[model samples]
Target: MSDNQNLLAEQRRALILDEVRRRGGVRVNELTRKLNVSDMTVRRDLDALARQGVIEKVHGGAVPVVEASTHEPGFEAKSALELTAKEDIARAAAALVQPGSAIALSGGTTTFALAHHLVDVPELTVVTNSTRVADVFHTARQTAGAGGQRSGSPVVVLTGGVRTPSDSLVGPVADQAIRSLHFDVLFLGVHGISVEAGLSTPNIAEAETNRRFMRSARRVVVVADHTKWGTVGLSSFATLDAIDTLVTDSGLSEETRAEIAEHVPGLLVADRATSGSVPGNG
Candidate 1:
């Protein structure tokens, strides 16, 4: 494109970004009409902004990027933010679990969602430091027994430790317990995910505990939603290269997905339409 064209594109992207930040999100068709541009042009602008890390592209629109390095939201607070996306990601992550495999689930809203899906997997062993995650299984077992049915398998092991604002168990007790055990896979959840900071959390103790979980697991699968793409947290526990697979919702932009695909071995974009994962990278 020419210099004038480039300048016009920049100006249009700025306006597009402003709308996204103002409304919390913007649809492509709406932007096309507002900006008097073609649908393809609006998409291009959104893609550029997404690549710049200033905005996140959804299925047909864009939303402001969240970038908090030190701030940590509580479990209840985070749970209400992305309900649909979390469920989609959880489904994709759960598909990776085998019937009798051992797995570790870290604490966070997304991982907590995954816990509910694992309740019916037979002969599975789950070790988790999050009391909330463990309780999911415990509650399932209780409900099954009440119905006079065996909810066997998926034996839950809750680690002892201090709890964070996100309801994750951390500190020395959790770390020691995780270090001695091994798992087939780990479905980790994080406060943030970024190219520079990787998978991170605001709690230092939780970061350490997550590292122990990573070390004990043979394969690492990060279960995160699209909104986490540009966010950074205070303590980074693992880098993108360490992840064996990443399962996220389809709200992630193609540009962002390609960029992330370069770092991880596999990327699975969970689509609610199909209720399955679309492989980003083979």
Candidate 2:
């Protein structure tokens, strides 16, 4: 069974809450479809949620514990939040990319923002898995030309492979290409982070490849917003110990922070938005 189906009780409850918040009511079909779990497994999940008063069980679905329109936010609905957090994290992360550095920007809104920030920095090369990020770098080069600037834009390499539903390029081809390069740093976007489950995501193929990326890189810095905390997804490819630093929003709970600190041992936690004083910051 997937971790999403058998997560620790807290992680499972957090997912249920996020689901109800995203989709309002949860029907057996909807839960099974979105989570990629079996119908029986979803029912068991719904039953557990209902027993905790976390949801109201209907004949064929479950409603929110609270009365509200729990509609899933569309991509546009999430854009503003994505932009703000990404900007903060990107700024803090960008300072680490020194001249002559070669780095990989994983496919994610956060890394996409980092690409935009790199426009002014000179003498760096970037490998990426996001088409949108590649376009940004290309545009930045044109902007440089129009301004009569001689500084070259960072080399942008886009991974070629099958695109996932979430718009990430993954699998053997992309992974092999990534393996060919040595990077000073790898900035990654993540779906879920748990103390025991490590770093989990919904796609198995991407998870497998990200595991390899973590192994290949000299440093792996995970960038995520507060929403990922306490959640568990379908696949786990790396452990907390594998991460060098975690940049997230300031909204995380102290308990969650403490658990992660205990698990990752020497992990550094930075609230990208505030206290820009990251661990080891001068």
Candidate 3:
């Protein structure tokens, strides 16, 4: 196809996605007939939308991407999706923690996944804003339940502050508490990251609260899924250069990966290939 044709195809894909989201599931034959395009063209459009997480491919059609109805899922609900990717990213993030290190776990499903993997990492000090992350480790500490690295359990510290609907501690109190604590590493799991927008969240107060952790911590390691790329959110906490390392899945686009490597100096891109994560670790 010509460059112009490819560009037009891209435009068509966007329109198709908009239509699918507006009208719910869209059948392949119907879209092909309505748009006066071949079935292959319709299939290609669906494929591209799925890659961007804007839509889901079905047996013969495409459906609007079904996100967690509540972005803030309870423990059981959050555990259901992205379990493997989150675990793999968690292991890589945890390996950065030494036996006697002070670390911070931000609020998110991915960070909560990281909390479970950190169970056996002993002698480390964990300071987190997420009630769930703290509760997970504290419950293990009290119950003596095992399932982590089989080393030693980390010391748990939960900040006292106003809880958001997402069960995350944020606002002035949380920011102050985080600033007072000097951490060896702060693990942030956020909504989106762009070369321009940096690390962002959907809430303004939470974003501001996270900035305090970024300022106080010695190193900032961001853990996110591949889908976070190109996505936009409400508030940006840190620029790309501000983060020390980025640990994400290998599914990120080549263009986005190249952009990050160029814009963010000394940013360690850790995945199964470059990092110690087992292949298919997630």
Best candidate, TM-score: 1
lDDT of 3 by residue, 238-275 (tens): 88888777777555545556767775543433344344
TM-score of each: 0.79, 0.68, 0.70
**Best-to-worst ranking by lDDT:** 1, 3, 2
TM-score of 2: 0.68
lDDT of 1 by residue, 216-246 (tens): 9999999987767766789998899999999
For lDDT, the strongest prediction is 1
Ranking by TM-score: 1, 3, 2
Residue 225 lDDT, candidate 2, scale 0-100: 63
Error of 3 at 280 (Å): 16
Worst 10 residues of 3 by lDDT: 273-282
Error of 2 at 200 (Å): 1.5
lDDT values, one for every candidate: 0.85, 0.68, 0.74
The segments of candidate 1 whose C-alpha lies over 4 angstroms from its true place after superposition are 1-68, 147-151
